[model samples]
Target: MIENQIGKRFAEALSDSITDDDRVEEARDNLRQFCNAMEQDSQLGRFFLHPSIPEENKAALVMEFCEKISALEEVRNLMRMLVERQKMCFVKNVSAYFDEVVARRLNQARVQVVSAQPLSEDHIKKLKTMLDRVLGKSALLETRVDESLLGGLKLSVGSLVADASIKNALALLKQSIEKEEVLSEFASG
Candidate 1:
């Protein structure tokens, strides 16, 4: 919970620093790229997380990385601040929340749709249209196939999940049956 707050604070700070929507997007991309590098390169990750490493070295490395990625000055400052505060571990969290903040700022909703099979373009378009109407804002739909769903789709918008999958339906049915059986036993007793 504290980590989430920390991540949100940093994300908001970065988001507030940039005035242009395009610059905000660029900063987000730069942050994602930096986080990806940290995740993909174990040595680099170690360098950031290592306690004994000098702060000067870490700051220098961050600056060098920002230059390589053509990061915005705001983004560079964010990284430097994180390094100084020893919050390198929260980079991924910050990136994730940064996306959320940006989406909110742009009056967009990021919806994740998981289905048993790949959805056709027409289907996606229809779904997006429906979601846009329901959300009252443009929906940024991200679709993925998860065969375990059996059928139907699961829609995730931020913390809310609407599970219409066959697997979930089966689980709900089973729970209902169990509850009915328990109620029947009590009545008989």
Candidate 2:
């Protein structure tokens, strides 16, 4: 809970900084990249998030890395703020929320489409077009093929999920039969 509270605070501050149209997108990308690098290099994540270290030294090291990756001033300032406050673990959460905030500002959405089989370029392009129209904003579609999905497709566009998989169909059928049985019992009562 404490971590979530701290993450929310950082996310809110970052969101506020994104009001300047010129800075939001690039800032979000840089932040995500920084967070990705941190995730990929666990040692770096541990070094920055370690509470045992002197805050100034940690902040300096993070600032140096932040400067090396991105020219976006907004991102640099955000990195400095996180490092100085020793809130570096929340960087990943902040990056995710930052993207959500920016997408909301643009009236756009980031979507993930997963399928058991690979999709052609035409399939992906058509899906993007349909989603953009349905969503009323441009869509950034991330495509993945997970064999566990077991054919059909699963689309997660913002908070809504469209499941067209056989697994979900079977689950729905099972749910419907259960509901029907319950209703029959109530009727007999």
Candidate 3:
């Protein structure tokens, strides 16, 4: 929880610093690349999290990385600030929250749709339109096939999930029947 708060604060600050939409996206990409590098290289990750290491050395390495990636100046400064504050361990969290911030800023909602079979292009378009209308924001749909659903679709938008699948309906029906059986037994007893 604390990590999310810290990351959200940093992400909002970074997001506010950029005025151009393109730069915001570029910074996001740069941050993602930097975070990926840190995660993939254990030695580099250790170096950043080492408390005994001097901040200057870490800041210098950060600058080198930013230059290599051609990161925006704002992004570079943010990285330097993280190093100075010894908050480099939260880079991944910050990156994740940054994406959410960007999506919110762009008035876009990412929706994950799972269905029993592949949807046609027309069906996808209709679904996207309906989502946009209902959500009051543009919908970015990521669709996939989940045959276990049997039929119907399951949609996930952020923390909310809407399950209209045959499997889910059957499970609910089963639960209802079991509850009714227990109630009938109590009445008879």
TM-score versus the correct structure, for each prediction = 0.85, 0.82, 0.80
Superposed model 2: Cα runs more than 4 Å off: 18-22, 170-189
lDDT of 1: 0.95
Please list the C-alpha lDDT of all candidates, in the order they appear: 0.95, 0.82, 0.95
Query: Which whole-number lDDT from 0 to 100 does residue 33 have in model 1?
Result: 99
RMSD of each: 2.3, 3.2, 2.8
Over 4 Å off, model 1: 176-189
lDDT of 3 by residue, 1-189 (tens): 989999999999999999998899899899999988987899999999988899999999999999999999999999999998899999988999998998989898989999999999999999999999999999989899999999999999999999999999999999999999999999999
Q: Between candidates 2 and 3, which one is better according to TM-score?
A: 2
Kindly list the per-residue Cα lDDT of model 1 for residues 103-179, writing each as its tens digit: 98988999999999999999999999999999998899989999999999999998999999999999999999999
lDDT of 1 at 25: 85
Q: Candidate 2 lDDT (Cα, whole model)?
A: 0.82
Candidate 3: residue pairs that collide: none
Question: How does model 3 score by TM-score?
Answer: 0.80
Worst 10 residues of 1 by lDDT: 35-44
